[model samples]
Target chain A: MRRALTLVVSGMVAALLGILALGGLSAAATATDKEAANEAKSVSEAAKRAGKKDPYAPVVYGDR
Target chain B: MVEQTTGVGAPPVRRVRDALPLYAVAAAVTVLVLAPLAAPGYALLYDMVFVPRQPLSWDLVAPAQTLPRAVPMDALMSLVTQLVPGWAVQRVALGGAVLLAAVGAGRLVPTERLAVRLLAAVAYAWTPYLAERLLIGQWGLLLAYAALPWLVRAALDLRAGRDGALARVVLAAAPAAITPTGGLIALGTVVLLVWDRTRLRRSALVVGGVALLNAPWVTAALVTGAGGSSDPAGVAAFAARSENWAGPLVALAGTGGVWSAQATPSSRAAPLVPLATLLLLILAGVGAGLLRRRLPPGTAVRLAVLAGIACLLAALGVLPGGAAALRWAVVHLPGAGLLRDGQKFLAPYALLLVVCAALGAERLVARIDREVAGVVLVGLLLLPVAVMPDLAFGGAGRLRPVSYPADWQVVAERVAGEPGEILALPLSAYQAYPWNPGRVVLDPLPRYLPGTVLTDDTLRVGDVAVAGENPRLREVRRVLAEGLPVSATGVRWVVVQHQLPSEVDPATLRDLEAVHEGPFLTLYRNPAVPPESNPPGLGAWAVVMALGAALLVVMAAAISALHRRPTAW
Candidate 1:
């Protein structure tokens, strides 16, 4: 019964969780347009501190 | 009788009652599989479309999703998409699992009806695949695994009442028609059934059934490019991508992504999985030994052995102790030949071992640890999950935010300031367009670019022979002269990712154009474009995708509620 309840409640929670996930995501999606100056500043500072690991890091043949 | 309906439509009442549990399980699986769409990257579809065929060409055509050996099961999805109106092929894979799992559980413990139903839910709920967090985006694997329990159940069904030879043959052969791995699993299982029973006729029939089912896919592969068409050297190079023994297993066990190294606590727990897996293997061996004398005649011992072999194969690439084993058998195993990242075989290995270990735990639960059954059984079941990094549950998904690479908005904003057509390289996060109905030379994609050669090894710029050699300069010159380059035909801003290293300079080659720079990418102007030429802003496909998705959700919900459930079965 507990297992069954876990499945059921977990399922319900998954559904409820879906709303949160959706809200969190879509909010972020539009918020993407609202580029905070602070984020840019932090990103620039961090780039200087650490190396720039651009998203597309190709597999350098020799590096591999 | 129980209102028997036949031929084209809804199954009879008795059949419905018998399969009710499967129905619930199927529904749950369908939900979980499609749920990834709510996340970014449309990751479920993206993985399905791209990972199998990484490194895009200028045209960005999606041929890799269906190329090469043509996994029989995934090919069936192309047919499913073609024949079955309005069905997303990915969901069908999950449906297949839910279906077979239903049958398998139904057959194994029919008396435990509620338990069977619950297990079906837990099957998805707690599966390593479920927790792996990444979508089980492989349509072929889904189809292949789905057919498993059905085959197993059919074997058990043969043991029961009426002669079930034909059904067993069909079920056993079904996997062979799906994915090769799945087909292998099916063939192996059928071989076990036959070897144990000494039933040559049965074995032949099952094998024949699979061959018959796969006839079209095999023919198609031959026509396009079968395994023969594969670049032996290229494939070798790809498969040559080496990983540690534990990599695949660690990744697979981390199915939920909770146990991922990126997850906060992953490093602490990751090293322990090999130990747990080893313990489970020993337990499986002991379980087999203890039950050897009291087995279910032929099939039991044979199946247990086959399952053992499958586990050994997966572990050879995963377990720390398997180094000696992998070295000894590396030449003889098919994994050495075809299985790249022998670690990917980890997921399959985990499934096999978990099942075997579950059987062991089942025995232990019954005989010695009935009092601590929950502790011991759940512990054994969770060893892989706990050790896995992906299974971390951060409230719901990940605790940290996942950012799409080269944020589209930033790219678009940079383009707005430019006075020419914006041609961009392939964004790592999403597919670029070619048809924005605008002057963006490389719409979102550039398949329209001629001589967009794709070879066996490198994905894009297949024309380039090793990176250092400068044949690419000639190709680029040719491309610049041709329609493939955005700047070739009067587009000013030639935007490319700075990360994509090319030996040639954008300014030096063309001898013309001013350049605008974005924080992420560089935009070069085509001096050829007459003054005051400006391409329209980025096109509206993302909007189209958004609208199409909203409509699909409504359609799916409506279909779920209004469509008569009986017709679906």
Candidate 2:
């Protein structure tokens, strides 16, 4: 009975680890994707502002 | 079969072999977390600015107009960068913080099981508190977080009257005392843990030693012309923020809620993350009994009290009637502004939680089958990393290194040749330069250049504008708002940073003589005010004396600790 219980517990923990691993990976990929999107936006903005004499001023400090 | 021992009289080879796993685990964690720092240049994130060589200027040592938030930290950096380059210093500081944090927590656990120790090591080092602080680039506070477990151990030893323990306490706390918030945490830890009615004299000495270590920042705060009071708006601006539906309180309970959303790990927003926090708390509760039984009488209770105070302070801004009370205190009480960003005080709570949870894991496995216990311990070890894997590879590449533009060096040289007060234009306290993409960093001009550089101090947290107490910055803001020329208000040099989102009106630079103009930064000298060199005053010297005294205490403790036959540490 004890051996069976140990096996059951081990299985539960293994399942938990798999779920957590997937969750963590998805979150990390989301952050990377966000960064890439921001970079693309910056590039487009720079192209639009090209040849302009006056500097473009955004918000001094970013949102929290 | 062979037997091993780690007692005082154990063989040196055996001890090293026994400790090999802990060291390996710690190294693995450090390498995994800081893999991005292996790149060539400096990582200049917000408040984490490192220059090639920070000139030893009086303003860096002691501030005359502003609050001494970075008091001895900047001064120490300036002194160290004189010999060692800034890039090396940055690597050492970050690497040492992560590695020492893991080892310290692993060593602090009372369990005999190696798996339990490793659990504590990984759990403590990979905490959300450490992650948020590191992502926000508050490396000084991270040093405090890293030093805490070691400090607690030394304090416990001092309470037990162990030889050289007092010196060990001072040595452990020295790194934490680099910043004011860290200093207070160290002082609070020593007082709570080491205070004893039986050994009153020794307790007083230990507490006094840690107090003196905090003297540099305290002395600077006393002498600063910015005065002690801060804007009450900051109480709301810097409060602990809720990452998910768990709310701010649950976030604090899990040791995850920092003020800035940008600083928090994205995984924290997962709805299930709160469930993990609940599990950890339940485990901590299960292990509380073990902790009380294992520790010396009253010691566990004292640690609990310290942890309680930390949690209370961290949640004060979000609590009922707590924000109002904190607001009133910050406005009326001197040095109370330090309490505004109370999440930084969570270091002690994070340490205590990890230690207790590790013990809880031990208790859980004690009654199980041996093979099952091994599997469970392995699962526990992987839990922290599993929950927040993005902490690996430098917070998912948020901490990538970038080289400073050549314009910075040219501006520094010009300012060094003729030193005077510099007004940084486009008038922003923090900047998002084109060179350092996707990172909002504090204007590096103040530390990179020689003389006193005045940048805007107002902090914009979302849409809420938190006011700063620098009188000079306020005057400069007024001058600029009225559309006055840069030369009219500035004492000497004016730097106009280009390619930033903020624009500097061409009319503002009409009267100033352009000294050096580059693609990134433009240096303009105000011909109206002649260049003048200002020497350090008596207040600055007093701060220096306090730093020197703190150094002497550490040195004396070091000598005393080394002289002892068997080191208690």
Using all chains and alpha carbons, the TM-scores for the candidates as numbered come to 0.52, 0.94
List, residue by residue over B1-569, the lDDT tens digit for candidate 2.
01113444688898887778988999988987888789889987777899999999999999989999997999999999999999999999999999999988988888778888889999988999999999889999989989998999988877777778889999999999999999999999999998887888988888889999998989999999899999999999899999899899999999999998767877788888899899899889988898888888988999999999999999999999999999999999999999999999999999989999999999999988788888888888878888788887788777878899999999999999997899998887888788887777888999999999998898877667788899988998888789888777866999999998768999888988899999999999988888998888899999999999999999999888888856545
Our tally of clashes for model 2 stands at 1
**Which candidate number has the best lDDT?**
2
For model 1 chain A, the run of ten residues with the poorest summed lDDT: A55-64
lDDT by residue for model 1 (B1-569), tens: 01112112455675566566556655544443334333333122212331111212211221221232333333333334445422233334444554554344333322222332333333333444433223323445555555555555455444432254445445445643454455556656655554334556655655555444544333333333112222222222222111224544443433222211211222223465455446666655555543343334554555556655654554444356555444444344423333422322333333333344444555655654333444444344334323432322221232211223343345444444543333444322222221111001112212211112221122221121222112333344456556354455444445555433232344443544435455544545566764443222222222223224323433443454345344544
| Cα displacement (Å) at residue B9, model 2 | 3.6
Where in model 1 is the C-alpha error above 4 Å?
A: A1-64, B1-34, B38-41, B44-46, B50-67, B71-79, B82-87, B95-136, B155-165, B168-176, B195-199, B216-269, B275-295, B308-337, B343-352, B367-569
Would you list the clashing residue pairs of candidate 2? A57-B501
- For candidate 1, what is the DockQ? 0.06
Q: Interface RMSD values for the candidates, listed in order?
A: 12.2, 6.1
Cα misplacement distance, residue B286 of candidate 1 (Å): 5.6
